[model samples]
Target: MVAEEKTEGQAAPELAAETAGRRMVVLEDFKPVAFLDDDDRASAVRRYSTLFVVDGRTRKGGLGRVLYAENAWGDRLAVKVLTAEEGADLTEEEQQALASRREAAFRREYESSRLLTGIAGFPTLFGQGRIDGQPALIMEWVEGQTLEEARRRLSVDDDGRLSPLVAAAIGRDLFDLLSRMELVDGGLVHRDISPSNVMIRTQRASVEEQAAQGKFDLVLVDFGSTVLPARASSLTVRYGAPQGATPDYAAPEMLTADVARVADMRKSPAVDVYAAASVVYLLLCGRPPFQLGGSSTGGEGAEVASDYLRKTTELPLPVRAAHGESADVTVALDREGEAVAAVRKALADERLSPSNQDLKEALVCVDKRVGEVVLAALEPDQRHRPSAAEMREGLAGFVEAYPANVVAALQGEPLFQDWSFDERRKAGGFEARRRAGARLARWAAVVVALGLGCAAAALCSGVRVTAVGSLPCSLEWGFPLVAALALAPAAAGYLVRWRGGRKRSGLVRGSVALAVVAVAVEAFVLSATVDPAAMKGLLGAAPLACSSAAWCGMVLEYSMSAPSAWATAKRPAQGVSGKGGSV
Candidate 1:
């Protein structure tokens, strides 16, 4: 007998009792639930039974409930079972149709699992079976949160956007997965590629080692919407065009209004390409490339309906149409030209703009090339979008540019590259500029303070210039003049730089001033009389002069070497790569 459904927060013993005696009926060769042929109907299908028990808690998703279960062999599994609305009435025919639909969905997912079993980034399937009269799939239980959950944990910026560097890494993994999918039987399209469908798990060896290397594995799941292109025509006729895909991430082509006209076009891998780009865009900026009415205020259903309308009846008027250039506007343009025009108009939609400034700031951490690639992938026309393989190639360059140090910084719990010189200033790139300005000010202040202190000491020591090339050096006149010359260069240079003079000009002026001071000091020391007492006085003056000059030169060098204007505006490439796909 079937056990009664257990409510949430039930006692452990009660939960165990609820799962007792559940038999999983596994078929050796599964057949389609609908349109079963004679061969499928006549055979006594080979089958087996496995006793499995649900343990711990249950997790819910859009289409099903997932619970942790262990088979008779004590191997853990994630069993996804169909979920029905609590209260609904249906006629006999309606009930059977729903049952057939549910069964077909289960079979489709099972087939996809089998097809993708050996592919990296996907979980291995155990088998498909029935539990309490509901279809369930037994697959490897991945241990980690969904990518959506990971975002909240990994958000390290002032705004909640994930670092574009990290997002690019994730996007690269996604494109790699898609590229591998293309190799299977002339390519498979995972029509649904949303955050909730991707799992983020640590490939834990040693936490320290992995953090140092900056490695984590992303596993793609929920393959029920997977489509094999060769069978697309039959599937379209049977199941309708533009099969189930998440609306927010779905491509413009996937949501076309006249499904019949684009049925052939739907078979291309471009749908997945668009969705992958949208996912990367969302990660970088915290919103999709396009949304209805400037936001998702009206909810998902409205957005889905609006997307269909936008791609069809409500598409923008062409450039020629608005200008009234011709009475017969459609006479000269071909299909490709119309597509190009439509794409241009679509790209101009304000809704397609990033919802926040986070994207611009995040762009500071990645190559401009990465941003270009992402924009190209989000193209409205499928022909304009690069293949998944191409995207992977474009991203390879920038992804390689992120140094191991940046990865190490990212791996710490804080999730920010605080140690990175570029990452530290990536938030609007203003902080670095501010710091640079402050450093210059501080250096100039130090130079002024030290020069005053040295000049005061020289005056108190009673060091006087004894002569000036055959003229007797006056005690009062020569000392003050020499002090002024030594101090004038740095002081004037600081003022000049502060007044917006070029750094190189200030450096040259300071160098000239220092040279004159050096020559004056050397001449005074050499002209000193042969008496030890007079030589001692001259020697003291030389030390004082050298100290001030050394300190000033140090400050000047630091100022001249300060980061340039470009450092604050554009990030240096941390890495390099051949041309390839971008985020």
Candidate 2:
């Protein structure tokens, strides 16, 4: 028989009884209800199953918070439970594998969450008892503002922006504390650092919360996804992107499953950086960075909306747009747009980063420690990424090294030779200029920061189109210095570049030059204007240094990319008579 849901005017139905170990199990089932508290004119109805669900929409765990809860003790205490049954019903082997997995997960939750002890406000482990019919574990109930809530309470301003200083401080406290758990005694990565797991309460009752047996002060709850022995090396495969990373927080690696397959998931920390950037974006912008404003959970809805807005909107990075002035104005529109786009790209995709200029600008407004913590995890190449152990050591150095001095030295560990440095420079003719430019770029950054005010604000004010072909040459020096210094071995690369390939005619050189000039100008203007000052700063006063240095290296990267020029141009030439009397 089809069961009917309860009506707004009806009382909650009592549950049917079933036998347990000794006691009885009852399930009243979830039903529909109407809210009476609303104004007389507001008519609203929702489904609620007495099977123990608390708040419906807000309570769901998609964002890492308690999603749906069952009230065991007259509804005062709520518990979130997920069972293997919820997944696709498995065959014998699948079921056994699933059972084994859940068992290990339950045990890990009990052990790690139990150890949170005095550090980091965490949920209290209540009791673990087998239900009469089903298996369930009980934990202390959490109440008050989630980080999202704090954002909302403080979000009265229509814009929903938090000061960079305030956002950074909050970010620092949370990360510095979280870093302490990188290895968590032996080896464990929180694996999931999205904002929903973080909670900041208005009332901090340390003693009371302890007395109540729940760690409720600025607590980070919901460790259901924490990595442990039985846990998969990557929670990202299942809980990432739409399910967890959410469009705004989802890293490029976490986005497409295809790219994910080719890349090193376990080694790439960009996944986490993407999440961290989203959090920073939300804290600073009020609205989550990439996700569109609304109840769009992680899904195509959020992805589509975020993309639309990102392409059209002027939302600046919290580091730049928060105060409205740190950014500059005279930079030109094309440049400003490019800069913003770069900042957006950094937050969305790790591969798009390595922007020193953008880094400097972001650091200026962002919390010094927050910047440090974020960088400690960002590297496009998996090999260059810091490990949890490395992160621990780096963090130790960070806290002890007078926070003021961290930025100048905080680059990801130098790229390995296998990464091939020199092959990147010879492509562009800016080899020597690239080196000179790197220093000046850093110097110009200080000047811009000190003398010009916020380059971001300058971007917001108006658009300034840069001249094509020839650049100021002074603005883009920083990138090449590192690439050149790093690739001194390839100093004679240009002389040897055409060594093997068909000799280049003036037309090919002109074509390549024109193409390079067009790309450089566009890249620079875009990079300088919209990308956060921090990101822009990294590019320095030059154009694509590393790529320019290693001509072969650059081509290799391009080779794997979509359709190439050589392939298209050479396709038609293949028809040119193979023999003397051919066609």
Best by TM-score: 1
Q: What does candidate 2 score on TM?
A: 0.41
What ranges in model 1 sit over 4 Å off?
1-52, 85-95, 203-212, 233-243, 293-303, 309-367, 402-583
Model 2 regions more than 4 Å off: 1-58, 62-78, 83-118, 130-134, 202-217, 229-244, 259-264, 267-274, 289-318, 325-583
- Could you give candidate 2's per-residue lDDT for residues 307-373 as a string of tens digits? 4345234443333234343243223212223213323333333322435455544344333443444
Worst window of 10 by summed lDDT in candidate 2:
570-579
Candidate lDDT values, in order: 0.54, 0.40
**What tens-digit string does per-residue lDDT give for candidate 1 at 549-579?**
5445445455645555533343344421113
Top model by lDDT, which number?
A: 1
Error of 1 at 331 (Å): 57
Q: What is the lDDT of candidate 2?
A: 0.40
